[model samples]
Target: MNTTPLRLLIHGASGRMGQALQRLGSEADSGCDVVAAVSRKVDARVLEGIPQFAASELHGVPEFDVAIDFSLPQAFDAILGLCVARRVALVSGTTGLSDAQKAALDAASVLIPLSWASNFSLGVAVLHTLVERAAQALPGWDCDIVEAHHTRKLDAPSGTALTLGEAAQAGGAAPHYASLRAGDIVGEHLVQFTGMGERIELVHRASNRDIFARGALHAARRLHGRAPGRYRVADLL
Candidate 1:
């Protein structure tokens, strides 16, 4: 690692993950100093000490070595354009991206290293790995995924659950996704593998959103010295 602390710019500074990142950045040993925070309409108190900006104000701003974004899907393209143009590394945790958005990221990677994942929780990545292994191990076993998120979340199946399902389907038959939304449930995923005599269940639960923020921090550290490319939480872990 470099001797000096990395300067970081945070996007989506008003969202849940962004708030957790703010707390994480304030703590000791975070390895990055938050120099700037961007949000569409952030509460002034939320960014009380940090320099803040509107999304449109990014142009010609002093560049940071890394930019971590938990912004929504709608803002992804703009963020990517800004990061790549600035030659800054990126860690985006936004979900619900369309196929075209992914292709855009792929194009952006040619200019700077960029890591993107639906969920940044390390546990979720482990769950995905386990699901992939189980799906491969039990060929004939039936597969189903049940996922729960906060009621306010608009996307179905949650990105983590879909990631798990995709991993579960890797090198095997297709798996199905079942989504559930209720009051402020942080997250939950259960992947069941069924056979004639027995069933195996893989479960991952999140008590709070901080896990993802921490994971994103870890990813930022891991991705710091790499070349231009995309990465996932598993790669960082």
Candidate 2:
């Protein structure tokens, strides 16, 4: 195993996942360094010692090996452009991106090593695989997906839910989706396959945001030396 620590950059550093990454990535055993943090406004009190810069200040910031973005979609283009320009690997978990933004990400992936996932939780990735297999086994079953997140979560049918639905579709099932936004729920997803008299439900619940933060860091480590392309959590799994 390589003992050298990876130099890391955290985008949207004031956000929940960004703060989680900062806390975890600061551990001595984490095998990475948080070199800089980017946000719309640099909050010195929240992000002390570590260099904090506004998004507009990114061009003046020095390069880091990899960048983990948990920012909003509106900040994505700037982050993507900066990463590509600096040839930095990117690990992003931002959701609810516009189609044009996604296309741009695809285009940028050709130039920098980029790994983006809706949910970075390892269990969620496993849930996706299981959902796929279950969908394949239960032919002609009605598939419905339900996902719940905190009320502040901007996207309906959380990106992970959409990814789960896609997995079901890939396994020859057409799935309908429903989304719920309630108070402070970390995250929860259920994929149900209903047949004649029985039903199968595969569920994943996240009680904390740290799972995603850890997973994104793991992805950044894996992406460090990777070639330019779009990568997924499944690849890490």
Candidate 3:
């Protein structure tokens, strides 16, 4: 096994997930080194030995093995382009992407190792697996997925819920979705399979945002020096 720490570039250093990555990556046993941090604005040139850069200075950062992105959709293109140009791996959890950006991601995957996901929580990845298995086991059952997030979340049905539906579809089940946005609920997903008299419910609830950052960091460590292709958090797990 490779003992060397993977070099990391943090792309959205000011956001919640980005800050969590920064804090967690600073730990001695993280198995990674954050070489550069990028945000829209930089008040400091360096923080705790990691060089910080404004988004405009992205081209000036030193080389890195993988980049972990949790920025907005508007900023997604630039980091992706940089990673492809540098021939390095990328792991992004940025959401609200348009069809064009997703197609661009598909195009770039052929040239570099990259993975983009809506949520980067390992529990959600395991939930996705369980959803597929349930769908496969209960043929002809009615499947419904209900997802609830904090009121701040804009997208209905949450991206993780949609992905779980896709997993159910792969197992020959059609799924219905319902979304709820309420106060301060981190995230909750319920996949229910109903039959004539009995039903099965699979649930996953996330109370902390740090899980996403931790999962993304874990993905970066696994992603470095791999074959070029798009991947899911489940694949890395």
Candidate 4:
């Protein structure tokens, strides 16, 4: 295994995902080090001895080897420009990107390795795989995806649900989707498969956001030496 530690920059150091990443960074493989954190407002201490930069401060900083973005949609373009300028690999978990923003990412991927996923939990990845297989095996199966997130979430039909739906389609099934944003539910995805005489359901749940943080870190490590391209969690797995 490679011994050199990967230096990292986190783009959303003030948000929930950011805090989780910060905590996970502290306990990550010895081969990983979160070198800097960039955000609009951050506790100087969260840097854990590394520098903390304002969002505008990114341009002045030196390049990092990799970065994870869980920032808002508005942060995407600037972050993409910075990452591309630095030729750094990126693992982005940001959602609600416009089509243009997504196009920009696709263009940027031609220059540097980038992995983007709506949901990073390993369980979600496995669930997607299972959904894909089930869809293929039961082309006639009727499928529906139901997901619930925190009430504060803005987007309906959470990105994870859409990803799961796409996976189901890729596996040869059509999927209807639903979303419920209530209470403090971290995340729960249920894919129901209905056939001639029976119904099969696959469920994956997350009680906290740390699972995503951990998965993002894992993806960052795997993406370091990859060729420039767009990738997903399944690719990393």
CA lDDT, every prediction?
Answer: 0.83, 0.90, 0.91, 0.87
lDDT value for candidate 4?
Answer: 0.87
Model 4: which residue pairs collide? Answer: none
Worst window of 10 by summed lDDT in candidate 2 = 42-51
The candidate, 1 or 2, that scores higher on lDDT is 2
lDDT of 4 at 16: 88
Tens-place lDDT digits, model 2, residues 31-80: 99898888898657235557888888988876699999999999988889
Best by TM-score: 2
- Candidate 1 at 158: error in angstroms? 0.9
Best by lDDT: 3
> Which residue runs of candidate 3 sit more than 4 Å off their true CA positions?
1-3
Better of 1 and 2 by TM-score: 2
Q: After superposition, how far is residue 156 of candidate 2 from its true place, in Å?
A: 0.4
Better of 2 and 3 by TM-score: 2
Query: What TM-scores do the predictions have?
Result: 0.94, 0.96, 0.91, 0.91
Tens digit of per-residue lDDT, candidate 4, span 1-237: 668778888898888898788778867453677788889865564356667888978787556899899999988888899889889899999998899998999999999999988999888888988999999998888999999999988887888899889999999898998889899999999999998899999999899898899889889989998999998898886
Order the candidate numbers by TM-score, best to worst. 2, 1, 4, 3
Candidate 4 accuracy as TM-score: 0.91
Give the local distance difference test score of model 3.
Answer: 0.91
Query: Model 4 — which ten-residue stretch has the worst lDDT?
Result: 41-50
RMSD of each: 1.7, 1.4, 1.9, 2.0
lDDT per residue for candidate 1 within 180-230, as digits (tens), equals: 889999888899888999999888889988888988888887888789888
Residue 149 alpha-carbon offset, candidate 1, angstroms = 1.0
